[model samples]
Target: MTDRRYTLSKNERLCGKKNIQELFNEGSSFYFFPFKVYYSFNKNKTEGDHCALFTVPKRLFSKAVDRNLLKRKIKEAYRLNKPQFYNIPTSRPINIAYIYTARKMLNYSDIESSMIRCQKKLADNILNAQNDEEKN
Candidate 1:
């Protein structure tokens, strides 16, 4: 069973208008069905692992309840799959924002699977970046 400590805390949430703007402006993103993941490596030492922000567009999800539900599901999925990414040997901390792009709310299973895929892809990306730097 996943420990309670592994659960996302307030400190693990990506915040600040300036940092968010930079992340959107400079980060690379990829779509995984209902989610669009934006990520970039942060070399600063504030956090050892990654921090995340979850977003659901108001234009797409008009109801506050619907938007909140999707947000909860997405967070749960990420919380479960985060261990793999955390275990990947890397020095730089990563910042991630998961933007919900789908018009409709997807089921939990779908969200979980997508989150898993996103984590694996993210790990691959980190590995590739490390390899590229080593090659230079």
Candidate 2:
């Protein structure tokens, strides 16, 4: 009913062999300036909400502190902007993983802008997917 309804939990962080495999195999993707999003619908595991996983590769961010900093920025952006996703119907749930693909660390402003762009794109994608389902 509310945006806070879709926040991710520890168990939904995209672990386990099958979930990881599905992420690689079936996920559709979108790329903003600094982030790449991979998402898929899991009929079996879905409830009335969506969940997310955020990742930053160690290869790109050599320092753990830098990685954690970026992760926090991304999380904050998500927390603030998640109402857009929650506005969608609750009958089906989605699993999304966002990978930070930037080569350099960015400030909070840049991360917030990128997150807004990502959320807009995600909303568009969901609408299109729903339209397609209605057509079929």
TM-score of candidate 2 on Cα atoms, chains taken together: 0.86
Clashes of 1: 0
Off by over 4 Å in 2: 3-8
Question: In angstroms, what RMSD does candidate 2 have relative to the true structure?
Answer: 2.2
> What is the C-alpha lDDT profile of model 1 across 1-136, one tens digit per residue?
2333558988789988977887899898888887888988774654565779999999998999999999999999988878777778776788899999987778999999988988898789878888888899
Superposition TM-score, candidate 1 onto the true structure:
0.91
The residue-by-residue lDDT of candidate 2 on 1-136, one tens digit each, is 4426545456546566777678768888988889899887766664755767889999999999999998989988887777775677644778788899999888999898889888888878978887888899
Worst 10 residues of 1 by lDDT: 1-10
TM-score of each: 0.91, 0.86
lDDT of 2 at 83: 77
True lDDT of residue 59, candidate 2 = 98
RMSD of 1: 2.5
